[model samples]
Target: MKRKNVKLMMLAALFPMLCWAAGEQPISLGTPTGEIQGRVMLPDVERPPVVLIIAGSGPTDMDGNSLLGAVTLKNNSLKLLAEGLARRGIASLRYDKRGIASSAAAGKEEKDLRFDDYVADARGWIELLSEDSRFSGIFVVGHSEGSLIGMLASEGNAKVKGFVSIAGAGHPAYEIIETQMSNQPAEVRQLVKNINDSLRAGKAVNDVPVGLMALYRPSVQPYLMSWYRYDPREVVACLEQPVLLVQGDKDIQVSVGDAEALKAAQPQAELHLIENMNHVLKSCDTVDAGVQQATYTNPDLPVVEELLNVIEKFIKP
Candidate 1:
């Protein structure tokens, strides 16, 4: 018997809901540790090349919701992106990072984790994909912190076709954090400095200002330490495979300079700088901090079609 393509074409419903893109049903990939849940959207015909989408930092869910409340991608980014790919005859896997969503089923807390543990979990996902007959080859798509996760997971995986970084940092994590801190008001800057000093002195930042707890939570120090050891530019420089570096020109949290740094590090990397796009890939009214926060929780906002088009072209069979 011939195998049918698992991809589903989502058109504007023949009439009523035709314009809105249809989403996919959730699925799971069982690993040694626990089951990781994700949604798979494939074209209605044949199975398409698959892409694995990883979420960014903080308490972000699979749908791109951050705990900050000030920011929300109105729509579930991973879910919508996957469904969009399916509409284009492509497939995608968007899973909650360990300690997030369905993966949280394991009861392991993010605060008690290390950076290497994430790399390991990513590797497990890769291994799962390789063993599954459904996918042809996987493209590792990492957003923000996930970009680093993808690079670390792809180190020697021949099954990984390429790597994509969306709003990824170009410098070391702490360096970027320090740069971000410098832009804060004087009081906040001083408090940030104190926390950094405490961390540098090998003391817990618990004694510092309450404002710094976001960065100093006890359960997350090991992961922070592991993340601090890596330089993103160097990692991209050393990658043996093709890379796609996408950044938003209007992103305040991550500057366009970061994108330039990545290009400088890997002259051959494909760079796409979208105008008016923010860190979350949504079109922005302005790049100002205040305006950006206002849209964080508005899931109705749509991502720039340009980004989806570029990604589709890159991952197509």
Candidate 2:
């Protein structure tokens, strides 16, 4: 027991050195609401380009885990991506969105949360990176719903050198939701369409049905209204910085056609469609919904190698 204790002490003393060698550290940004918490992964190289990685929708933390009810979706996709970039001589900063994980104190009341609030937080991070001298350049990488947030944040920001969209939808949020609900019964689909139409018109839906209450709850309708106003293609087309659009053919949630549509919007942007890569950035052999969902909880599964390669080239090239 004495020998084991000594070894543990030695390992604890060496842990900081190991982290320094990998250039991993906790970072934070102060906002009017609260402090937004994040993790920064830097390479050993001097003045490396840093990418701000914005996570997808919901309660996704800095490491890409999402809490759905009692279940925690523990795919370390963003964490692995940051580590991979650090290994390739690039730096990255990934954060828990306001009101998520460590940054829970920064969350606003559900009724007061606007989509622009997220955009503001992302812009704050960009400004923070701009003031840091250790980074030679700043890039924005947005995944899923974050793609739209990053687009709005990077639109007129001169400090943002580039933007990358991964597994992003090309249309507005309402259209995407409509597509996802197409398999429901005609009555249900029509009900959803009516609710969406009301939200799209800048109206609050107060009389939500019991069956659809979870999705169209009163507190969340304001946020949905804000989210439905922007078309991603329109936003991406306005970006002055270089853009890279990446999509996976096997991504069950987002389609490759969405990336193509984004490319069509910005003719100068580069588009790469990776084969067999799923929404979580893992290479799944099949597109079975159950099989793809398994990757979401499997932290041991590493993200696709081509994802790292393409992102590295985009940032360094």
Candidate 3:
């Protein structure tokens, strides 16, 4: 279907003019440990602004697809965004996290990655991009949890010019998760509360329901704990580079409060709150569940032009 066509087109491009309009192509960044899987597209113009894209959490690929039900790779936001940027004379690099995408050891190791492992991989990419002459400078666009990784990789690093935090969490991650769960049905909310309480008490959450266990398991605990150790506000405050905050006013996952928190921490960061836009940066449906899930399946939907304009203007300056 649509996904197939897009992927085919992305891999078949030759000339640079419409290269960004093409689908996602495999990019290999040779790291110390091994090669990392990613997709890179350059604009038709030479020496375009290079933007590195980092995806959110849980099996998300370079294209912003997640394994969650009702969401597929077909609705990949980054895929279209990168392609759009290419058509606009911007270069981009988007990658699958270690063990995702086309990595040879994918299924086996993705489940075991630590937070530091992701940060190290990002650093490696930064180093590689810095050495390349085609790119003027690295501008990192991090979505959701990837924003944290981008900040971690760019702190005190002179190579990165700026950061675009899209749907990023400003407070502690667990706090945001807890807040969202608090409004769920009483049973679901209570179940999550109990599991969180157990974790906070230094006890294993094994007895929690299977639905909750998927998000709170031993394999993910190390990362959750590490994530709790730093606050996005604190991290952003330490970063000297320019930052742009992009948030969807209707996004149920991360609220405007998150963006406000970031702005308060870093007064210089630019904030762009797109009205009616959801977590995925697409036009949302008026209905409840429809809007939250629409962007996951509709690749034709484009991100808010206002947001893109802000980013382009910032990078150009």
User: What would the TM-scores of all predictions be?
Assistant: 0.81, 0.92, 0.82
Each prediction's total of clashing residue pairs, residues at least 3 apart in sequence or on different chains, is 19, 0, 1
The candidate that wins on lDDT is: 2
lDDT of 2 by residue, 1-317 (tens): 99999999999887755545456888899988899999989898877899999999999998889999999999999999999999999999999999999999999999999999999999999999999877899999999988999999999999999999999999999988889899999999999999999999988888899999989999999999999999999999999999999999999989998999999999999999999999999999788999789999999999999999999999999
Ranking by lDDT: 2, 3, 1
TM-score of 2: 0.92
lDDT for each residue of candidate 1 in 67-106, tens digit (9 for 90 to 100): 5555443446666666677777777778777666577874
Model 3 whole-model lDDT (C-alpha atoms) = 0.78
Clashing pairs in 2: none
TM-score of 3: 0.82
lDDT of 3 at 275: 86
Local distance difference test scores for all models: 0.75, 0.93, 0.78
Can you give the lDDT of residue 189 in candidate 3?
80
After superposition, the stretches of candidate 1 with alpha carbons farther than 4 Å from their true spots are 1-23, 31-33, 69-74, 183-214
Badly placed stretches (over 4 Å) of model 2 are: 1-22
Model 3, poorest ten-residue lDDT window? 14-23
Among all windows of ten consecutive residues in candidate 1, which has the lowest summed lDDT? 1-10
The digit string of per-residue lDDT tens for model 3 on 1-317 reads 99999888876664444433443456787654567788888776767889999988877888887765664645778887787777777789999887775654533353355677788888888988898776788998899999888998889999999998998899877677778787688998877767666655556555656777778876766566556666899999998999999888888778888988998999999988888877777777443765467566777888767667777887886
